[model samples]
Structure formats: C-alpha cells, structure tokens
Target: GLPPLAGFFGKLHLFWCGWQAVLYFLVSIGLLTSLFSIYYYLKIIKLLMTGRNQEITPHIRNYRKSPLRSINSIELSMIIYVIASTILGISMNSIIAIAQDTLF
Candidate 1:
C-alpha cells in the first residue's frame, strides 16, 4: 500500500534543499563574475595612472600615452560606468537571492 502524503513530503524536502541550494549557487556565480569585472577595471585604471611621458615629445595641449589616446571626458565617463555597473549588478543579484530566501 502507498503511504499517504509521501509526495507532499518529498516536494517539501526538495523545495527546502534543492531549490534553496540552486538559488545560492546562481548568486555566488553572479557575484564572482562581478568581482572579476571589478578586478579588470582596476587593472586598467592602474595602467592609465602610471603611464610614461617625455619632455621632448611632440607638441600637444593634452598628452596621454595610453593606447586609447588622451583620457578625454568620454573615457572617464565610460570607466565610471563600468565600475558602477559591476557594483550595481552584484548588489542587485544579492538582493534577489535575499528576496527568494525570504519568500520561500
């Protein structure tokens, strides 16, 4: 004879163990990717900060030796955007994880 409520018990266990675990897994992956992006942005910032210059260089009003030419306003805005996206993305994903935990 089949036991009564076996299916319900099984589903409850899966919900508490399997789905919860998967939510955490996805959150961790998102966080790791965000951190990696942050690291890459910092590396670029460092390269731009410690670049070389010369006194006998060609005449120019604003000179930047980095690969992307001088650090213009647009470049600064892009760097800021990349940094902000990384932070915001991580935070939003974390909030989602928390919400899921609270809901279920």
Candidate 2:
C-alpha cells in the first residue's frame, strides 16, 4: 500500500527489525523488491489514470449502466475495511503500545 496505508508501515517495521537483527542482505533484498513493486504500482496507476485500457472502458461503462451496479455488501465491506485500516495506520503507535503491554 501507499504511505498513508498500513502496508507501508508494516514493511518499514519489518525492514527496521531486519536491520536491528543485522540481516543486512535480507533487508537490502526486501528494499530492492519494494522499490520494484512501487514502480509497477505507479505504472499501473498511470495507465489507469490515462485510460489506456480501451477494451475495459466500454465494459466498465456498461457495468455502470446496469441495474446491478448498486453497491453490494462486498463493496460496502471493502469500503469499511479501507476506512478502518486508514484510521488504524494513523494510530499505529498506540496500537503497538497496546500490543506490547498485552504481550509483555
């Protein structure tokens, strides 16, 4: 995920732990892979924003016009999940403290 998302923090924490453990090679490899993944993600986002997928556009338009285009339970759940994750990411330090307190 992006900077404002949990995935970014999770990866960052993992890399930090790896560094603390002296796993330099593993950390380097992970950082390299993350960079490649970010590059692809940005490429995909650019393609989407540019509407380069001509074939899918028509299908998407048709889907939007369909009566079944109404938001379903699955979409609602996904929206809720995104909102919750964003909130959790923002409050992650508190969550880590809570977990450490419970675990220790």
Candidate 3:
C-alpha cells in the first residue's frame, strides 16, 4: 500500500518532467477538471429534484422552481473559454502525437 499523500507528492516532485512548463499541461488539467465539474453538476441536480438531502427537513419542496445556485455572466464566459481552450489543446496534442509517430 502507499505510504501517505505527503510521500506521494514528494515522489511526484522527484519525477517532475519538462512537459510541466508547456501550455498543454494546463489545458489537459482544465479539461479533466471540467469533466469532473459536469459530474458534480449532475449530482447537485439529482439532489435537488429527488430531495435527497431534504429528508432531514420538511419545509423545502422540490415542486417549486427555486434556483439555489446559478451561473453568472463571468462564470459562464470562463466556462466557455476553458472548453474552447481544452478542445484546441487536445487537437494540438493529437497533431503532435501523429508527428511523433511519423518520426519514429
């Protein structure tokens, strides 16, 4: 079994590569985080609709259209920007991979 999270980070630091400096690194991380966010977004919707967290309380009804959270303009634009950047970065990665394949 793994030692602990601190030991894991220490080992990760030991293996840090030059690719960490590249723009594509952030792009890949952002893309993965975006997917994770979508998963949680679905979870929140399920919680609201099914009143999964409302069992403890009885006043709140899911029948009403109550928006407990919302996406503001800045947040919406950032999401769009991140999605576009991730797509472009993944496309660039594909091209690079193909080029590397042809070279070898």
Candidate 4:
C-alpha cells in the first residue's frame, strides 16, 4: 500500500510537469504491471474459492473458527489505510512540493 501510495504521488508529479513522453511511458508500464498483478491475484482467489473442504488437508480444515471473527476488523483496517493514502496522494500538495524540492 505504501509503495503504491508513493508511486501515485510520483506519477502525479510527473504528469503535473507536462512531460508527455515520459509520463506516457511510465503510465503504460504501470498499466501492464497492474494487469499482470490482477491476473495472478484473481487466479489465486479463484483457486481458493473453488476448493472444497474435502479436498483440503485435514490439518488445515481443522482450523479454529474464532479467527474468522477478526478477519472483518483486519480487512476494514486495510481498506481504511488504502483509502486514506489515496486521498492523501490526491488532495495534498505538500507531498509533491517536498518531493520536487528534494529530488530535483
């Protein structure tokens, strides 16, 4: 999440400079990587969803049900962190200013 957050701001700064050639190249690379990631992630999710308890190992199937209650909280926190970082990247100008000041 942090890496993506940083990348979002970096790309935003690049685009803001009106460097069309570099920006387009970087964006194309980003799109290709994103598609690759989506493909693998979806494949893993499909594999997990399609599996039956009978097909899984007995030790894994014996897992406690208590952990299920905490999954909602964990997912909620992760979602909030992602949303907050995206908002920070989009609405805050200080990050771009600092990055420009330091990197240039």
Every candidate's lDDT:
0.65, 0.86, 0.63, 0.69
Writing each residue's lDDT as its tens digit, candidate 1 over 1-104 gives 01254554664464457556777675566556656865776666665687643432465426455776667766789999999988987799788999999999
Ranking by TM-score: 2, 4, 1, 3
What would the TM-score be for candidate 4 when compared with the true structure?
0.33
Off by over 4 Å in 3: 1-22, 54-104
Which structure among the candidates has the greatest lDDT?
2
In model 2, which regions exceed 4 Å deviation? 1-17, 54-69, 72-74, 86-94
Best by TM-score: 2
| lDDT, candidate 3, at 36 | 82
TM-score of each: 0.30, 0.56, 0.29, 0.33
lDDT-better candidate, 2 vs 4: 2
Worst 10 residues of 4 by lDDT: 1-10
lDDT of 3 at 30: 55
Candidate 4, 1-104: lDDT as tens digits = 12456665775565556456657676667666767876777666676898745655677677654654866655679999999989997977988898999999
Give the better candidate number (1 or 4) by TM-score: 4
Clashes (candidate 1)? 0
| Residue pairs with backbone overlap in model 2 | none
